[model samples]
Target: MRRLLVPLVLVLSVGGSLGGCGWAGRHAETSKPDVFQLQGYVSVGGAASGVPGTPCLAPTSVPDVVAGATVRAADADGKVIAVSSLDSGVLAQASDGFRCNFAFRMKNLSGSRPSYQILVGDRPAQTFQTRELTEGKPAVVTVTASS
Candidate 1:
């Protein structure tokens, strides 16, 4: 009976000490920077050129300016964390006869899976994700108007 009691106490002590060490290590790892800035570009595009008198599709271009557009970032729980609006200049000249660029920036993000949405006036909202947005680089998100 005495020998069994001695070994049990020793095993418990060692287990407790190891568990505490793991907890400390996990806390240390979380001390690094976790927040980041999410920046990107949103462009609303559609068929610009067509046959003068018939139905002909032209090359893709950013001519359909999505005015009063607001971009938002939401978390896993659908909580909005950041937002930005498109500038008039960008909207006016967004299409360079090709793809136009509108800038958006959201700061203090957790660098996790974030949902992105472009809200345009009375149009079906263009929704997507931030998984493709590289760090330190502006991501390009193209939205098309529902016709």
Candidate 2:
């Protein structure tokens, strides 16, 4: 009985250590994508230059100027995780320029490197990896609108 107990204890200890060390490296992969804050500036005609332009400028304008635009984040599986329009409280103006920031949650996302398609209004959609769209560093998307 003593001999059998020793081997069982050793096996359990090793297995516990291996499991604690993140076995199969699956611990790093999230079961479901996490909800992250995604904030960025959306300007018609061109991108925000981080410079306060003159009033009635060509590109920069008030927050309501882009109130009709929408921003969508689609996961790799083509699932729309978040959709934020420039209407209401989602739009704001900073010292630099007008911003259309939103809380973007992701779903159906896996793998070490997950990416999403960032669609901004009528402009071309931009692709960004999860690592590149972290907190504090917002993705800048520009679009051109017709008269």
Candidate 3:
């Protein structure tokens, strides 16, 4: 009886450990989603065109300018999920006149949100559906601002 009991205990112990390992792996995978990246461009239009050598206005400093401004991403319920800063503006000649283009990247965004609202500085937020923003594709957005 003692010999049979010893082998059964050993087998149970090994089986429990293996089952625990599998459970842990599945738990980790379901806990969170894969990392996602969101990229976009902000264009400021209806503003005085600046020369190549002139300093561009930062988005935060000006009311409508988006360059060098804080870009925030919010979920459908208006909860901010991710935040990033816009890069310096690159002047580009537009058909109307001139526009300042700024690029920004927000990383590790959750895929669970149905839509995303992007707000730059104090400007109004822009809404984008989940289908509009793919995992690796960059979304270009135009923001019109007057100087």
Candidate 4:
């Protein structure tokens, strides 16, 4: 019983260490644990995917912007563990505190890509360029303005 207890204790300790948000650094992208990602979007050192929605300056034909980006450790049942909102642009890594990014697109009347800013958590993130939509060229204006 004593020997069995020692092994069980060691195994439990190792498993616990491999659990929780601490594992975020390793499985940040592989598992959904503390993971969230949207398509058409780009993130650094993590997961990058496309989000469903038109640029901020989308035309009437454009639909609502849907942000689908995140990463989190979840259960086998697909239950959420930790949810983190993600933005597809430039990612800033903090050396001390926390930093976040956000953006919103507005359909531009001009054909040129419009520069805009997005607010996150009451704070405005840096400016990002996106398709504003011009006259009629393609069925839907497609732009990939990166800052």
Candidate 5:
């Protein structure tokens, strides 16, 4: 009886340790793809520029102008998946002239989508393939807005 009890205790101990390994938790984590971050720049051009043919006049006010504006990401079916807001704007020199460029970042975006449609503010959506965003590189998008 003592010998039998010793083996049974050993078996139960081994089984309990394996159960505590948390296989289910690890599987749940592996089942989901890693989330990606989307970083972009919003360039306000046309009449929205404080000064035509030059950089914005009041650089500080650029942030106020774009405040509360949102950046949205939609799947092929036009389902809105994630959203972010413009961070802040700064005057940047451009070939045509100068423009107010605002930077933004959207986190926790799934890379499972075949493609994405990005819409900044009220501008039209721009389509991008999944590879463009998930290639282990920073996906910098430039959105042009007009007044």
Candidate 6:
């Protein structure tokens, strides 16, 4: 009985020591910077006179921009709201230092246009409305909300 107790205690001590080493090892690993980000971009596209319509607006300082491109978003009914474009410079002022704004632009694609409600994650940040788009020029839309 005495011998068994001695070995059991030694085994337990070694196990605990190994567990601590594993934890330290994990912390030593280099990882990406943790940050809050908003990113979106256009997928569909068109062209004119054998030339591509502005494939996408270059990202700038606008809240409605995404990776220097324009894209669109929609609701279930498919109502357009606002145009989004990439504006990385503007988002640099986000209250949350780690936050960003990236989205696809949206023009009045349907008969009825929807109102805009900017979001960050699931939280509503702002709201706005856009006028009807008469020119075929695509409208920009940005979504700085996390998916």
**TM-score of every candidate:** 0.47, 0.45, 0.64, 0.19, 0.61, 0.23
Q: What TM-score does structure 6 among the candidates reach? A: 0.23
lDDT of 5 by residue, 46-76 (tens): 3243443343432443343474578888999
Residue-level lDDT tens digits of model 2 in 5-24: 99999999998887785553
State candidate 4's TM-score: 0.19
Across 1-147, the per-residue lDDT of candidate 1 in tens digits comes to 999999999999987896775543455564644566777766544445333232322123433344336766665565666777654424222343323345667777775566555443333454556654535656566655455
Off by over 4 Å in 1: 1-30, 46-68, 89-97, 114-134, 145-147
lDDT of each: 0.54, 0.54, 0.72, 0.32, 0.66, 0.37
Q: Where does candidate 4 stray beyond 4 Å? A: 22-147
Best by lDDT: 3
Candidate 6 — which residues are off by over 4 angstroms? 1-66, 79-85, 101-147
Which regions of candidate 2 are displaced past 4 Å? 1-33, 46-65, 87-113, 144-147
Q: Give the higher-TM-score candidate: 3 or 6.
A: 3
RMSD for each model, in Å, please? 12.9, 8.4, 8.7, 18.5, 8.3, 17.6
Candidate 4 yields a Cα-based lDDT of: 0.32
Candidate topping TM-score:
3
Model 2 Cα shift for residue 124 (angstroms): 2.4
Candidate number with the higher lDDT (1 or 3): 3
